[model samples]
Target: MKKRFCIASLLLLCLTSPWIAVAQTVILESPVRVVTSSDRSIFPESWLSPDINAEAEVLQESQIEPSRRVLYKVMKKYPGHILARNLETIYVLHRLKYKGISASGTNSRRNVYVVNRGSRERYTDAWIERTFHAEFSSKLLRNFPQYLDNDVWKKANVESFKYGVSGVKSVKQKKALKMFDPSLHAEGFLYAYAKSTLENDFNSIAEQLFLGDSRFWSVVNKHQRIKEKTDLVIAFYHKIDPKFSRSFFVSLAEVESAEIG
Candidate 1:
């Protein structure tokens, strides 16, 4: 009985040793929450370091902008944090928006339709290959943020603009048509509209653009049968250049032909 009790105690100590080690390591990463004298919670405990808690408290007591500054400062302290990873994603998307027309159809208006498809395999792989960083743990952080960034997610778009006139030939246009979804054609048009009229460039006003009785389905439906349709409302100013107008119909026709074949 004495021998058995000694062995049992030894086993418990062995099992707990690793846990205690892990706990000690975790304390190095754990942050403390600071409550300001003014009754404000300066920063959540989960996001800050024990050393920074006092700084957060001081910032809060001084009535400074706590949330934004905390995020910025915390990133400075623990640049490898998951929050820093997400912030990098945000920064990348913002950079890509000005690059124009994502291959993933980000700002191109096909976003709503693309969501219906079960697989985002192509887009996911593209992001993982191009934008994957060591810090992001959640798949949601990588994928959905592409949609939110407008059209900065597309590779073909970058290629098209780089090649310019050389890339606008028939063969290239046909390939471009394939990347586009039939349902999102109107959103593309609306995007162009928003660009030409409001800001002389594309910007998302998703709320106003998507309003209507059919919930913006009418806008999408209008482009369903271009041959039967007499007039098109392209761009924001409705400036219908007959030449540019033909490009829209021709592109859709190529898509239909490709689908049939």
Candidate 2:
């Protein structure tokens, strides 16, 4: 009875108050949440620059393979030289002699990387040091099986596969076929030179220089073979760039050994 009387009194008060006739109102609002690292962004947004956007548009229109796009970008960075340009021109003229593409001016040198699947490249710098190795060397090694047994990495790789640690399932199929000869040669160089490096996490200068030679297949797992290839590469570098001495690589290895010790 008392509760009903209180409610009645409140209603009566409201009805009697002149301020109530002014139209009472109530408003509700949600509180904003504070975001931190725990709050993830919906999208990764990059700064929109006009030049970058234009290049991206061109690449999108070309519809080339990832390898071709990478090759084109690499070729574009190669410094223009009279020898490289002239040699490329002469080669192109001879190749297209039947088609009358003259040997004058800038021939297909600049556009060599732009060839279709038929005019595939015989060599690329990526065979040495690329952004993605597993994709660059080892992937090609798979398609080219003949080189698989020749690398210093061969024994370890086979052991890994046998133990099921390499994560490669097609060991049997890979052993059965040969790949392009150049791939075999390059892969052989990598695995051989890979053994001769500064005892650090990074690749040594010697390893990088060794890759310049294509006939690194002469290198076997034997200690003397690795030294022979190593010496030849160092000599070539000496002829081209006088600053690079054998001691340069030796000192780097010594420094790495001391640091680790």
- Highest TM-score: give the candidate number: 2
Question: In model 2, what lDDT does residue 210 have?
Answer: 27
Local lDDT at 12 for model 1: 87
What do the candidate models score in CA lDDT, each in turn? Answer: 0.26, 0.28
Q: What is the lDDT of residue 52 in candidate 1?
A: 29
- Looking at model 2, report the run of 10 residues with the lowest lDDT sum: 34-43
List the candidates' TM-scores in order.
Answer: 0.18, 0.23
Q: What value of lDDT does candidate 2 attain over all alpha carbons?
A: 0.28
What would the per-residue lDDT of candidate 1 be over residues 165-200, giving only the tens digit for each residue? 321232234433322244434334333222122111
- In model 1, residue pairs whose N, Cα or C atoms come closer than 3 Å (at least 3 residues apart or on different chains), thus clashing, are 31-48, 102-154, 103-154, 106-150, 107-150, 107-151, 193-235, 193-236
How far residue 60's Cα lies from its native spot in candidate 1, in Å, is 36
Worst 10 residues of 1 by lDDT: 109-118
Q: RMSD in angstroms, all models?
A: 21.5, 25.7
